[model samples]
Structures are given as C-alpha cells and as structure tokens.
Target: MPLLDVKNLSVNFNTLEGTVRAVQGVSFSLKKREIIGIVGESGCGKSVTVRSILRLIPMPPGEISEGRIMFNGENLLALDQKRLRGIRGSNISMIFQEPMTSLNPVFTIGNQISETFKVHQKMNKQRARKATINILEKVSIPSPEKRFEEYPHQLSGGMRQRVMIAIALACQPKLLIADEPTTALDMTVQAQILDLMLQLSDQFDTSILLITHDLGIVAQTASKVIVMYAGKIIETGSVSSIFKHPFHPYTIGLIKSLPRMGLRSQYGKKPLHEIPGIVPSMNENISGCWFAPRCDQSMDICRKVAPLQKYIDSDHSVSCWLFN
Candidate 1:
C-alpha cells in the first residue's frame, strides 16, 4: 500500500482581495521508502499542498476546501488536533525550508531536539539528551556534545540544517516532508545534505515528499516527478520519463530551462531558456487552462476548455489540450 495518498486536495485562503484558490484538485500518492519530488516555480502551491496535509495552515485565513489526505489508510483530514499531534513527529516529520527561522534562536539545539523525544516518546531529560546527541552524531554534526549547548545562531547554515534534520529524525519518523531542504546552501554542502538524506532514508526506511524548485535535484534524487503549476498538477511520471519525454508544455519549458554542462555559445556564454509570461494570480477566475496565456503551443480550445488529465503510458500522465 502507498504510504501517503493526497486525493483531489484543494486549499484556499481568504484575503482582503477575495478567496484565493491556492491548490486545486491536487492528487498524488507515495509508496513506502519512495521519494517523490514536487517541482514548480515559486508560489505554485507546492508548500501549501504539503502544509495542508499536516493541518498546519491556520484556519482563520486558510481552509482545506475539499479532498482527503490518506496516510497508511487513515484519513489525516478527519483526525482531530489531539490525535494528529500524536502522529506528527513520531510517525511523520518535516524538515523546513529555512533552518535559521525554523529553529528557536533562544533555545540550545539539544534542548529543542530533546523536546520532541520528551513530547512524543515520553522520555526523561537524561534519556532525551542522550538520544539527541546520538541523532546529532547520525546527522554528522561535528563535536555534537559541545554543539548541544549552542544556540541556532551560533551554528553555520549547513550545520543548522543538519541540526534541523536531526530534530526531525529524532523519533525515526516513517515519512519525512522536506520543503526545499537544500535551498540557499553552497553546491558542495547541497550534495552532502542530499547524500545524507538518501543514506538516512535507507537506514530508517522512510518515504519522502520532497518539494523543490530545482529540477536538477529532483532528477538526481527522486524516483518519480510531479510537476505543479498554478496550484494544480500539470504532469506526473517516472523521473526518467519526465526528463526524457515530457508531455505538458510547462514541463517541457521547465526541462529546457536547466543549464546544460559544457554547452557554450560562440561568444563563450550559453543563454538559458525561460518560459514566457508569469503565472496567473490565484484570485483570477480562469475558465480554461491557467497556463494557456504563457504556453507557446496553446490553442483556441486550450483557452476555452480545461483539459482533463490523459495517460500517455501506464505511469505517465499529463493535462493538456494537445492530448485532448
């Protein structure tokens, strides 16, 4: 059975302007020990979709309008806060985008990490501290014993991120949601972090819901790729299929935008390809495809009718008028 299944999930926000549909009918599934990468440009609802799964979106401004998040056959959307808390951290953990902002500045790294063991596993201070140090060592934080007393601000960006990973994996969670876990780090550090995650995934047998804007990272790490655009999933398939035979225009544009190695223009510089036009505002009500305005191959039908998702093969699916 799949570890997580998000079925027709729609998330909306009430703003001063109007009701903004941030995620519309987004659906996907993840199997045990499988890594699925959700890729898209900024503000494409990738974060909102995952945040909704954990019921993290504040209710006053945000609402999960429709759909179910089925994790291990239990409907996460139906779980109450108290029940949900029991599952979070112990069963499912998250590594946030920014470590500095995510970690409490005033608290020592060990104290913050130990709190998870205390709350979720009911461990005493002595045991929690021991476990925290062990986890820090597991994440390759140098001088873990000494670093335990240090605050978030005292550590470098890469070390802080490793600390965050340590906290998330403290309870050996079965599922890990990484929302751009490698963003803003140097390339070498990025590779180290990715390698660490893959090794830990094997160690703990964890399924990963990896969210990122970098297609290269997805190409290297994920088994499957989900392309999100304008608050919806435009294409999904195996990584090999998505990279080599993309069907959706948006997916094609994204693949073409990646900088190729050893490629140069006559002027000794290679120009990168960029998709034209900006993503449509969520507040706007578009009757047809939201990407039509930006899509080079958009037709009259694409502008007039929204295309249903069509299957190219058993595993590859795309939503586009060209297939319709």
Candidate 2:
C-alpha cells in the first residue's frame, strides 16, 4: 500500500458570506521514502489539504465535507482525538510555514525541541535536552549548545527555520509535511535547507509532503509533482514527466512562468512569464472547470462542463477538456 492516500478529499468553510469550498476532490498518494511536491499559488488549498490530513482544521468554521485520508492502513479522518494525537508527532510530523508564528515566543529552543522527545519518546529532561542538541547539530545549526537557550526571536530567519526542522524531525517520523519551509529565505539559505531536509529524509527513511509555490524548489527536491489550482488538483505526474510534457494548461503555464537562465532580451534582461487572470475566489460558486476562465486553451465545452482526470500515460494524468 502507499504510505499515504488522500482520496477525493473536499473541505468547506462556513462563513458569514457563504460556504466557501476551499478544497475539492483532491486525491494523491505518497509511497515509502518518497518526496511529493504540491505546488500552487496562495489560497489554492495546498496548506488546507495537508492541515486536514493532520486534523488541524478548526470545526464550525471549517469542515472536511467529504473523502478519506488513509495513512498506514487507517483512515485518519475517522480516528478519535486521542488516537490521532498519538500519531501526530511520533508517526507524522509537520514543519509549518512561518517559524516566528509557529514557535512559542516565551519558550527556549531547547525546551520546545526537547518537549517533542519528552512527549513522544518518553525521554527524561536530561536525555531530551541531549537529543535536542544532537538534532540541532544535525540540521547544521551553529553553536547548538548556545542556541539551545535562545528564544525564537533571538535567531536569524535561517536559524529559526533550522530549529523548526529540528523539532519536526525530533522523533524521526515516518512522514513529514513541510509547508513552504523555505519561504522568506535567501537563495543560498533556501538551498541549504532543502539539502538538509533531503539528507535527513535519507537518514530517517521518511516520506515527505513538500508544499510550496516555488516550482524551482520542486524541481530540485521532489521526485513527483501535483499541481493544484482553485482548490483542485489539475495535474499529477513524475517530476520528469510534469517538467518535460505538462499536459494541463495550468501546469504548462506554471512551467512556462519559470525564469530561464541566459534567455534575456536585447537589453540583457530576462522577461519573466506570468499566467494572466487571478485565481477565482472560493466564496463564489464556480461553474464547470475552475480554471476555465483563465485557461488560454479553454473551449466552449470547458465553460460548460468540468473535465475529469484523464491519463496521458502510465505516469501522467491531467484534468482538462483537451485530454477528454
């Protein structure tokens, strides 16, 4: 069985305006020790999808309206709170975006990291502290011993991110969800972080769900890719397949939008390509395909009926009327 299976998952938010469908019929799976990248623009349901896997979406305001999240032969959405809690840190860990907000301002780095060990591994304070220091060093944090006593606000952006990585990998989880882990970092630091994550994944034999808007990072790290747009997964394939022959217009647009090296104008300036039109608001009831309005290759059928996912080959699938 695949390590993680998300099948036809849909999420909705109950708001004053209306019921906003944040995620719609999203499905994918991660194999053992594999890295899968979910790429999309902001508010495209990438984060909400992963958060639902962890049962983190608050109820009343938000709900998992349909579908199943299967992990290790169990339905995660069906698990009790206590049972799910047991699986969260030890079995599946997450490195949330924005370390400053995710990390507790009052707690020392050591305290926070060690707490994972204490709670999951049942280690004593001394042993947990030692383990925390080792994890810090593993992530290439400078002066691990000194940084242990520092709070989140005291560290640089890169250092704070490293600490978050340390905490997430504290128990050597079987699955790791990194939501835009390299956001707001310099190119050099971002590369370092990605390398560190791959190294740790190798060491721990962990499967990763990497969520990011940056396709460059996806190309560098992920073996497979899932392209999401307007709360739906528009395409999925191996990294090579998606990069080489993107079947969906949305996927094509994203790949074309990447800034190419040495492809500059007469003035020695490279023009970056952009997909025109904005992502539709979730609050509104969308008709036909969510991407129909923005798709350059859209047809009359595209605006009248939603396209089902069609196989381009054994490894590639795209949801577009062109394939249909």
Top-scoring candidate (TM-score): 1
lDDT of 1 at 146: 99
**Model 1 spans > 4 angstroms off:** 265-270
lDDT of each residue in 1-324, candidate 2, tens digit only: 999999999999999999999999999999999999999999999999999999898997999999999999999999999999989888999998797899999999999999999998899999999999999999999899999999999998888889988988989999999999998788999889889999999999999999999998898899999999989999999999999898898888888888776667544775667788999999987778999988888899998888999988987999999988
Write model 1 residue lDDT over 169-197, tens digit each, in one string.
88888899999999968899999999999
Error of 2 at 204 (Å): 0.3
- Can you give the TM-score per candidate against the true fold? 0.97, 0.96
Q: Poorest 10 consecutive residues of model 1 by lDDT?
A: 262-271
The C-alpha local distance difference test score for the whole of candidate 2 amounts to: 0.92
RMSD per candidate (Å) reads: 1.4, 1.5
Candidates' C-alpha lDDT: 0.93, 0.92
Error of 2 at 58 (Å): 1.8
